[model samples]
Target: MDKNKRILSFLISFFMVISFIVPINAEKDEKNIFKEILKDDFEKNSSIQEIDSAEQKIYMVGVEGESILELLDQGYDEEKANKIALDIQNKAIESIKSFKNVKIGEKYLYTTNGFSITTDRNTAKKISLLPLISSISEAQVYEKRVNNVRNILEIASIKKEYGLDGAGMVVAVLDSGVDHTHKDMNIDSDNVKLTEEIVNGLKSKNKITYGKYFSSKIPFAYNYADDSSNVVRDTLKERADFSHGTHVAGIIGANTKDGGVTGIAPNAQILNMKIFSNNPKVPGASEDKIVKAIDDAVKLGADL
Candidate 1:
């Protein structure tokens, strides 16, 4: 009977060991498969060329978290949803900061739960192993496509039919820069206006800095490319679209009472989120900058 008891104990221990090994091996296999898929995706999307492993390039890194829409569907308000995403991004960034060959740049939460990083291909593959990271993709460049809004979309008829003047709405325009000082943009309406002190301050200074010139027409403004609040056009020599942002803003919210060029939604307030660098060599807006602008737009309460 003692011998039978000893045999039973040995059988129990053997089974327990087998169970542990199976699970660990399965988990490892799953991770390996995931990493392989990531590698395929990285190469396919990025069109990566054979180069030194040490060379770095900009890549968009997605984080593991609930998206803004998902959070809202789960009953969180817009602000709370954004905050949660921001927290997830921040935590993930902190966890991976010490990793070699990775440098975090602008972080996004609202529109996209991710951050931009400057890292080489090898480090990016390693980064995919982290539980905090969900995806990695090469950044793409985008150019502005000028549109004839009124003729193409027939916005007047739609506005007339729907009686939509965009009152009580905030519109965010992501472009090079908005000439906020344009007479068409300064129309008086029910939207919030710039404070007297701010106007005086802008007028008194020889140069305007960040966050000082926001008027009632253009409430919130930021230049994501330059990392400044000055959204005014610096020069006209850069591109023909130097006044692109201002022109777009005019189309959306120009409410000149004296028969000036009127926009489709003259009542809507404008939020300036400039993404273009205006550099002749690097003419188009980078994906990272555009993502950052959208993230900021959501945080700043853009209705459109």
Candidate 2:
């Protein structure tokens, strides 16, 4: 009886030790897993007290699921890819509710099973522990790198050599917005430029210019930021709204008819998919926006 009692006591103490040590080991393992996936840039930037003091910062989070491309690569059709995306969104929405004050801003299902979250570092650390979440990194702002335009003659030579006139191809432009009124970009016979009245009408949210002003050159346009189909650059608004897209479109397919830069493929029709908002807080295309744009491009039949 004495020996049996001692044996029972040892077993109880052993389990008690394990119960205490197991949690510590698990926590350490969790931190190690997070450390592996947290990008170096975000890790370095997070050390700054100023950023930490901010109310919230945006983060690009990866979740546990295959992307649309991956699904398609695995022999799933377009319909299945879309369904998978929806499932990922639903799961992410539910998972986000588990964390207090952590909000999902955008869902990226086509490129990755991930979304953007607006939360502080402390909450983000808690979120990282979630079984569904695969990785977390701070959102980064991208600046447009301007380089000297290559000689038009060289582009023409390449086009001539390759016989690539971009005929029947839809080139999607995901930038601030496109100035369809630009003479070089206008491919329609009417050559309709947005008059001040129409511009004012759009500003006032009038229905007059809702479906008009878009030409054959820019056949389709959508502003993802505002969930509107208005991709026309508002002249009355900030310069950023109009400048970048038009410049980019010019370099892509600007017809040299009216003394514009003759792009490499002057025959490609432009698909204006504006991702930037007029709001200064959103500097460039966040990861979610970029992935959304790519998904749109696939659905809309963009060649490039």
Best prediction by TM-score: 1
Q: Candidate 2 — which pairs collide? A: none
Which regions in candidate 2 have their CA more than 4 angstroms from the true location? Answer: 1-54, 187-213, 225-230, 235-241, 256-261, 280-282
lDDT of 1 by residue, 149-185 (tens): 4341454555555555655566677777787777777
The TM-scores of all predictions, comma-separated, are 0.72, 0.69
* CA lDDT of every candidate: 0.64, 0.61
Q: Candidate 2, residues 1-304: lDDT per residue as tens digits?
A: 2443233233323322322111111223232344454444545655543445456877778777888778999999967886886687678668779677887786666656777789887677667767777777666544444444445466456565655545555666777778887778744233322333433454344122332336667766677766677666555666664677777777677776866456655666776777777666755655456556656555445555
Alpha-carbon lDDT of model 1: 0.64
lDDT of 2 at 121: 73
Best candidate, lDDT:
1
* Segments in model 1 whose C-alpha atoms lie over 4 Å from true places: 1-49, 76-87, 150-153, 191-213
TM-score of 1: 0.72
